[model samples]
Target: MLLASAMTFSAGAVTPGGEAETIYYNARVMTVNDHFDITDAVAIKAGRIMAVGSHAQLQELAGNDTRQVDLQGKSLLPGFYDGHIHVGTGPRPFGATFNVPTPDQLTEILAREAAKVPAGDWLVGLMNRPHCHMQMPNRWELDAIVPDHPVMLACGVLKLTLNSKAIELAGLSKDTPEPKDGLIVRDEQGEPQGVLTMGARRYATRVIPNPALSDDSARDNLRAQLAKFLPMGVTSVNIAGVRPNELRLIQDVYQRWGDELPRATLQIFLFPGYDDVDTSLAELEGLGFRTGIGNDRLKLGAIKMSMDGAIAVPDFRTLKPYDGKVRFDERGPWENQKGDFNGVTVIPKDSLYRVASRAHELGWQLGIHTIGDGAVVEAVEVLERVLREYPREDHRHHLHHLTIRPPEETLAKIAELDLIVDTQPNYTYYNNAFMLAAVSGNRLERQNPQRSLLERGIRIAYGSDGLPHGPLLGIWAAVNRLGHDGKVYGAEEAISVEEAIRAYTRGPAYLTFDEQERGSIEVGKVADLVVLAEDPLSVDPLRLRDLAVERTIIAGQELFHGSHVEPYHQRPPTP
Candidate 1:
């Protein structure tokens, strides 16, 4: 019988010379190394890979106390790295759908929530699936429901619907001048309409105290959230726009859980108009740390900035005007007068360059979110100027989500600059319909041009951006380029399964400067791996997302034994 644990031998047998602590054998080990080689087995010692070769070859390196796991001919690969995600440090908001809620239903829900809380307390709600075309409730409508409590309904991270009380509490009025790069929706009478977009949303959110910032249970909640990644074979994640308090909380979770939780890299975003460039830079430098601080479990990464809104919301800055028609359903078309609108530019050009220059000089990488073609051009121009002036090598400054394909010259400049492209393949799968409505057919055809970008020698990394943060889904979407409608949207953009896997694994490691140490299952690297039921390289591209993870191992220890767990004394981690 296969030994469930490492065999115990005399203390003298466990030597540090060349003995391995564990030998995982009888499996197809896809070592994502420089050569992308395949082996039969692998041996681990002291939380690092010691050897990888045939089962017989590894057996010679195993000590008497070495653990041996017979994989029964499963497929093993390096653990996945999620390039981008938003791990919220606040309590999850009460959720409702943007498409389903009627005025009465929304009012009823608000009334119920308002009654549960104290009169002066804040009541926050979230629209589960927010889109640009959906009709939003006005402040007057919300005031009719929860008059006493300050109500703020979030439509995504960038937009909010606030009641009059919330607006009052936030100190925003009709006369309150609009932020340089934010929008405060107004009525015909020149009064605040209770709708805030972009940086303006921060005003309401700042006043609403999130108990998770100081609550002890936040550690447990964060631990639980990080634990969820193990089941999906995600060993590393880079979270964008993390606040100071949230970073502290993340550290606490890692301290308690140690290697059991996924490794995290954080990016701090400077809110346009909300965060002063000079003051923010001073405060960051005063912290006595730049990017790449903290330990292996948690590290500071880039300073992120959103150049424009989300593409699906179609407020992303664009060179040409939007196609004024929104065809969400087959029933009919929704038309809006989008004449001469080239979308919203969140940061002024001067502010972007000033902040980027200082951050670069301070040894911080810049991660700018540019969804539209115009935004991409603007960001690239600024980066070009910064690099020309500073000329730092290996900066790895990245542009996130090039949803709208930029000009050929701009794309060439990106390649010339050696910048990384952190994009979400799952966006095509989940938001294709909305995207088609948001932009012209010609523009939509080039959405996430993975193959084109790869051809230009651009290192494109795959991320979920919270569109269901699963690497399998991202891989499937990247390989198939299929939408929810069961039709391929951008077939030319489809990549190979191997390419998709590399993007999800090795490509992201480049962002964290862990490419040599992690990302691959090479000898001398950390033994962070996942055992799959089938080989992803050989699986049908369409069924790739259905592949199951049999086990997840980090640092040579099995943290998650997948679905068919034999009931031993200990229970496995749960999602």
Candidate 2:
């Protein structure tokens, strides 16, 4: 119905100006407008879209100076937007190319890498394998293979296994007090077993020496890192959990090379680990800047905080005790874990509530990571109370990595509060088996409930969260709802291809307050679009991930051209 109306309305859709700088025709253009319109051509003037309609209708806006390009039956779409991501972070040193490496594979790789490095040098091995498969070697076992090197093996971000040398180098001992929101795992005799969790993992990371690079080198690395998304059809990304120094580097890169980088909104990470609530609040006040501080290219996004531990380790705060029936192949985080097994809350309740209230009062958007149902409920309750005390329309406070759906009433509250969700659908696809083993089947079915959330009029967006970041994989995971083992975990929650695309594009734009400027191919919106070898809507849903980006254009400039398209930059400048 919407598509029909869009076509009918196109007859009267006015072109922006009399002359255009370029006109692209003979393509299947998905405007992704209010109607999700499909148009035949689009005209660009300066860096904005001038018109979008039938080829004949748009041709009237073309002038003698305008350049014409034929898409030759390709498909055009609004560039993808990753609602949650990380900058300056990639695969760990000597880690497997595949994010998830089996334990045997990881140990062999680390051993080989250890031999190549100089004696006494630190060796860090990071892997994205789920905690269920994270049967890591203890310090003694690691010492057998890499005795000369100080080694730290990080499993699934939150868990860490360090050798004796690494512990010595980090200056940690059984007597060392545990950091706030962190834990030092100990054995029967209370000796440090070379294991850390949550905030405690920073001890190892802080002691790991890094290669110093010049500003130019750092900028080049940032540019190259962001450029990788262009070929994947991603044009805008919201990088969360960035430190202050990291923010400066990001700002510098954008200031110097704005045109070459993806549109970025960085969520400044805050709280007990990085800084106390008071200190962070003071820093924001002193800076005199809040969310939405920059232009379309780069912006200061929300203030992010993690409310609970990671889901991969099944250490996230939950409403009830874990079912605990599933067991890992070997000794893992949950293998013999004690207590109620309800998981840990990274942030104290009072602290989380206070920060949420204060941040909202100060006009800063909050992006709280709430992976467990318990955390989600707490966040919703706090936000509800905060809004009642100090209501602000369209605050756009979002919850990141909502791995489980809260109760229906809490969800209703979320809908009523207009809370936005930025979740990694690919996480559900990639870690479904592990998650199923960790949580109850009922909880697993409620995971990534995109369709249900949309039905309730709640806004949601898809992101990569740095685990093999790609919007295509996210969209595919969302539409298919398939696990790594080829099982459908949440069949009822599966969304259509069009719905997933919106979650990747317009949904993220709305989250970042860029809806009117660049989410769609409107007359005045920025011309950020991707030309695909095949139309996503026409292809098999299972093959969506295989779709190739032929050309990526941002603000009317082509930054990446695949083999299917002629290099626009190499062409002579239009006189």
Candidate 3:
């Protein structure tokens, strides 16, 4: 706690002689502010920005102690923020990095890994979808390859598949009761086909080897993940899905790497009523702090709760069924819906309100994952109850997903309630990847609805829901809305590149409740910014993904130089 207090003081105080700690010049600086201002240089002192102006103006403020650098016309902008993403804090073998499109390919890979490892050892693989033959892989297909070793391969945000061995190891059987919060896709014979949706992964999670996830593991994992983010110009992230069991190790890692890595804001995940909510709240209460307690490098964020599910599964709890043909209806799992609906609500409405209301009462900002319009309305309704009781206008409780294309009433309530919509623009790019075929005619108009939300004065923030975790990809998605098949899904929803950039930078800073200290190249803000190889505004929207981060600077230090990583800024001279 003393160290945290020291960091707090050191981050904001300027040094003697008002000398800058670092000075970056000769770059096009995008000050993502109310005016969308541009500048030529910035001066940082004690890990915070001291001034922003023309190169000459900043030079006048810099002293000999300043580490001056010329960007050579590169574009400098604030760090990209991922409003929602899950980092694996458990023991996971770095199995496959590449995508496997066919089920046979997956079988071949898993079979080889199975052979190398011990028979009883769980072969946990990461980074690939449940490779399939025109559909998700089944337990039998996986069993044919490796019936001896238990194999669990997970694709982040999607579903996970298990071989027969894994199915048994997780205690899943024909008699196994399905989780109230998730679906266990089963065959006609009433047997699980091996796909575990959303919260249902608890079956596999219980069996997956955790190794107790020591603090060292958290440091190593956070270090490896930060390496990946820094290169892509991501200097801040919302550790959006920190499960109940993983919280301790993650917090310990944060205490250690808070100043050493890219800044992070943690949003603890609230399991679907099965996990003791009070126990989780007590842990936070015992932390000697609440949200926004730590220094600039780290802070506690919102409470994350899932309401609806994914768009691919069409489980977003829509008001109507997907207006399509055999696409969504062709299912193996629960199709307990009427009309054109292929959706299901994950959390009980009453429980959602209870958890959110309790969290609000406990002084935590809320970020509920609500994909469907129905979920969005319900979320706002719950927030209204909290706001009416608490009377905190700036709580800034946000709605995640809303990918189901909210209706006018939902959008109006979002604006009226002063709610932030944490969107994954990258998911919009997948418009052509899924749902378009099965989607009803008019439903496509509401997907994302960025322009509409902005018009209604709603704050829109961008996040990469780990779909490759590329901010440029997300910006491209927002600006173009072009699907993989080369057609724009929602032309009216498309926004300008500047607006998209703001959503990534300024917008997220607000959600993290640190807009005053970040989100722009402004005076007195933390110098957590990225230097791009080219101007994103001038580049072709389609070519945005080609843009590279030349350097990533956090807290007055260049933590990322070109393709290389740098050490921490050494506590900013103790102010």
Candidate 4:
């Protein structure tokens, strides 16, 4: 088996170096290389780009079996790469709930879902963003809807809102003190308010029996999610924070589906609270998985760690207190005193540093989730210390969601350390109101710091964070720098469409150390590409999200083709 594996690797490395089998012609293809060149056509053979040049130049290599596809004056480009994604988790129950903008919407959604589900069963909802009109619902509201069932709604970052029944089921009460590195929000009456932060929620969730998600079910759901991404021109995603069981499920899908599993890299983060670093590392080694272990279809990339909470929840480690206004109530005073708010860190800085240092020593890349200024500072500090103590070449430690501060010194240090910044630009659109009101306030002008990071030559990448994973929507948010209400914040930090594209592609590839194999449309690279309805460069920046995907090809196989939704046919439709 070892000999066979070696032979296969050797064979794959040796390029076909032969005639082309297919030619895409008469279109603009953005290579996204250093030259930033656009070509008229691209030729492919053996699931690799054979040549990229004029339509006629590449057509010369085509034989009688060659397939020709005319772009009809449309656009073709390297598929977008979402730098950070929670891929193992299944789809959120969006349609089951109401579409309103406030907590009323959640109430309506819960009421509706409760009606459909049998009594005394768990009712789970996801994708609840804080700072929206739909403020995080409390246990009281959930109890009113489904008093018998245990309802758990995950809202922004690692916070979970549980119904009174859920608390009872989990045996959580006023006497149940907050766990280390976790928070349990209480009402003014000192009753458990249903909000469980960080490790506490995970603990409660583990005890409650999950709705039996099988590997087959997970695979099917993943395919559905991938289809949604392909239409939006997303070709690749980095699955951040996957556990061992979820990794097995992903591997099963990849083995059966092969390249059809979507252009992706799976980075399994050992949840610090669940597994020891040594045990997790041993498990990865036993699976024969090292960083950058597979083809473009799937690969083990980095180790992820969620260091802090999100800004919208006001739990993020901030350099200063949240703006002097309540997040849910506008006319109220700030929640904390006027000073530096350390925010919440799921793992202590010292512990996080130790974990990262161990991973670094073992030559594994590190990806840390840092949203608050304090979290960012702590992460950077730890990374710097680790590098100095045990120097390793090409240590690509990433700071995921550098939301609040782009401190010039820290940005420069990141560049110096060669660390990557994984940012979620779409959140700017979905949570812009919350950002402007609760997090930034008058300092909204200095938020994000995209421009500052770029100026310091920091490596940056863009991701949707999966609540909304459309590349065009992310690009629109970056280009516009405005919220839904037309209020623009930090206009100076906004980036061009081209730069945003680079962040989605090359930047992420560089971070994962997969730049050589993917992230661009070039000869010898995997044939993972997205055919677009309109030229991204030529389209109006404001209408970028309007652009649709014509098709998505992964390893020269058409995985998803754009077409109108058709009704499900049962038993041949009575033919």
Candidate 5:
């Protein structure tokens, strides 16, 4: 447990512990502790929660100099812990430039974006199709838009569509041999169609010059991303897939703006193709980093690995074939097709097992990205094998995005192995429609398997994956299971609002091994919390996403307040 008890202070008295700071009171606080206790107030000192009880009780402990704010009956809960997020690349570059719809809309957006850029400069865009409530653009469509400029657009996973210019620039023609873990799409004429799937995208992307951004520019972009999260009441995030350079930049900014920024948990997964298993682990260890290092402001968490691709793109290694429709003699989409389906492991399974086993031996945790059933099974097998061979207790290996598992049996194995499932319920709501259309069809009932996993005693955690990383949005999706066409996909699999909240907070914390300090709002833990406009449990399921955030506080300092409240940051005593 990474939690500490609140320091005791006399009622109506202030203790000058040098670093002790401000406190808050007079709020409807729901501390999702062992008892699921709800209280009227909370007190803070030295960036740790002091007391959690009635308003009268907490106020009695306030010191004469302690700056106090009345919550005025607003609702407050622990700040959200996002188990999965791609943070190293920062926010998507096309965030402001595109309102990506489906394939047609994406084509339109690309054409418009291409028109704006100069002729020769590479035209790059990221489209979130799995969750983007739209159609996916293909390589042919991209070619039609910018025939001159080399264009590369990546959909949610590493799946990419490239134009003729991009293919030519990367020196990939019909005869270009596919890389070990990648695929090159070709037309019926046996010519390259410019659709680079999975690992192949890396080749083209590497050749394209990265857009230049100064430190100030990077900070500005980061601030914009932070602003987006603040309103949604997200105070902390586990940034997935970050390189050392980006990590350094984030660390520099965080140290300088420690007082103002949101509490962040930085999980720097080595880039997929850049670093080998030993090299990556060595780099992480060389930084003098541990699984959970840093104070309330920022911390380094687990190492991440992508064990497979996504199912929506049909590259995920699935037991059944996705033939665009049900057929008697169907071939698994990626196997016989132009695409590859060895399932693009970030590192070889044996290498990943070795590295994860080493990490476990060193008291670190591992987070492996597994999307399809095969991928999930492979990941679980690896973890199980490593645990049995190395015998580390409380390893807490996490399987990210277990999108399409068969049933509770696999989850039961997970529970038995004590592995954690870091899932994204928001994907269900956002991708339900596309998933129904492209991959599973009526089998969508088997998708996600949240209810089944919970029932089987599997430890399940929730994350947004940032396509739509709003906790409220995720809560709504879990509760309602609403599809794109306004129909509910699997109501039976729908979880309760309370369960959903737990998955986002307590569950994720446990997965990250930070349950003791941050997940629940108990006395003696770090004072990282969110003040919502309304009680989530009390709101209608459909209205969950509509519920607004009134304030966000981390380490006893307010980071975001309602539009009506004043902005401020408090520091400990200087003496």
Candidate 6:
């Protein structure tokens, strides 16, 4: 990063040099341009693509001082874009592997992390896998590894395993009252087990000294997490859920790095709680800047609204109950027990409409998280009402995580409204098997259905809800539509390699209103790109998850080079 800050853009425009200021030839350049074209060579100057054509054609523009890289028959593509990621702040995994930890491995990981922290501190992480519930780690098992640190390893949304310290911290003694929407499991003796489920886990999360609480700590932690994105060819992201604290993180990034920062669009938080709409709107307007603020490296983009809760929305009104055969659990006051356990709208339709309408009227793009089909329908209802009230062109507002089977009519309505979507396609590959069983039985075919989304003329962008943040895994899931068991998942809903590529690149660029500037290898666009060892489309779909990004370049500067030739980084951001 110090190396990055040392350089700055010069006064004059950059032109092609003898070696052609970094001419990449003998390569499969998937332009992902207007026609989804493929070409061999591309010449770039400053940070913009100067030409894209045959090697002989672009060689004419090379200057004596130009640097060159002979791709030697590799593949190059527009840098990947993750449309919906919580790149700013969240509970990051504890292990170095950064994937699902097995039953035995989870304990070992806690041990390793425990060795790093003081005996009294906390160590926490998720079980990353869906079936982690089947291999639940009890208090004794956790105490065996990191006994000193108050440990809480969330095995699933509703399952939590707390060490004695964490339990003590939560004040969960035998006499403690059960959390309204949650349960504290008991042992044979009626003493609290290390498990507190659903709403009960919130008690611990409330008391934990989360790293994200400190601005400097959050910034450093975010960088550690984001460092993984570059080597995977992720150049841009729509960082979801920018609350007041997250705003401070973004501002910190801008203040520290400026153009050297990774490209991102912040989806500012807009909750639908009591007077929350007015409060968020007033805060946003009071800030004196609406959406689409800032330069290329960082910009304010969408306004976020979680229409439904994840699990707590004790809240998510689904078409059916989860884990149970029917909606049999204790219901919250806000819970909608209308049809089984379909999730409930945390923000009622009236509330959502008001917030959305105000956001639209005030010039903010919306990215509402809609989990169940039931939620999607309500989102559509809100969108229809808001658009009718305050219309704008190419609004590009989107619904996030439209999971499970969406009815054809809802998909049609999304297309009719020109609404965009962002989904974690990796769910297909990693979590599909369990999700197929967990969701409403009728909607099995719509776990993600990204292909269906694209076919219906809706722009679908890919995001990783952190099973794995690698875009290659997402691409593999999009193209193969297979679960971890290697079974076809929504076979008919599988997208082509090119379409999947588009979702990771141009599709997201459009969401950020940055398509014209980048997202492709077209001449005159920013040189935000990557080089790969092989063409992603031509490779076995199963091998995609392991595909390597040899070089990652952003704005004509090499940001990440891995097991490849040393890439030049003398140039600064494009003027």
Per-prediction TM-score to the true structure, in the order listed: 0.85, 0.89, 0.87, 0.86, 0.84, 0.81
lDDT of 3 by residue, 1-575 (tens): 01122212234455334667777889998988788888778777767777777777666666777788899998999877766666775334333333454444776777677777787877776534212211456678768877887777665445677878888888988889977666687777778888887767889878877655556766687667755787778878887767556666666766766666778888877754544556645654554444676667766888888887776554566776666433432254324434554555676677777777777777888898887777777778888887887777588899987776777787787888899999887776543334453354667655766888889999988888766577888888888887554667778888999999999988888999978877887666777899998999998888787787788878877777774322211111000
Which stretches of model 3 miss by more than 4 angstroms? 1-16, 62-65, 91-104, 118-122, 127-135, 168-175, 208-212, 244-248, 272-289, 312-314, 324-341, 430-434, 563-575
- Minimal lDDT window, size 10, model 4: 566-575
Error of 6 at 405 (Å): 2.1
Query: Model 2 reaches what TM-score against the true structure?
Result: 0.89
lDDT tens digits, residues 297-385, model 1? 78999999888766544467788877734454211111224366576788767778888898898899999999889999999999999
Better of 3 and 5 by lDDT: 3
Local error of candidate 1 at residue 138 (angstroms): 4.9
RMSD each, Å: 6.7, 6.7, 7.5, 7.3, 7.4, 8.3
Q: lDDT of candidate 1? A: 0.76
C-alpha displacement of 182 in model 3, angstroms?
1.1
In candidate 5 the C-alpha lDDT for residue 193 amounts to: 66
After superposing candidate 5, which stretches have Cα over 4 Å from the reference?
A: 1-26, 62-72, 89-118, 128-134, 271-289, 323-348, 406-408, 441-443, 563-575
Which 10 residues in a row give candidate 6 its minimum summed lDDT?
566-575
| Top-TM-score structure, candidate number | 2
- Total backbone clashes of candidate 1, pairs 3 or more residues apart or in separate chains: 0
Tens-digit per-residue lDDT, 1-575, candidate 2:
11223222133333344578888899999989888989778888778777788888776667789899999989989988988877663324323222325555656777778777689977776654543233556777778777898887776667778888998988888788866566676665556778787878778777877656677766776777887788777889998878776777788888888897689998888764334768766666665778889888999888898988776655677887776555543234443356466666788767777777887888899899998889899888888889999999989998998888788998888899999998888877666544655676778777767877888888998898865577878888889887765668778888888889889999989988888886788776788998889988988988877777888899888888874321111111110
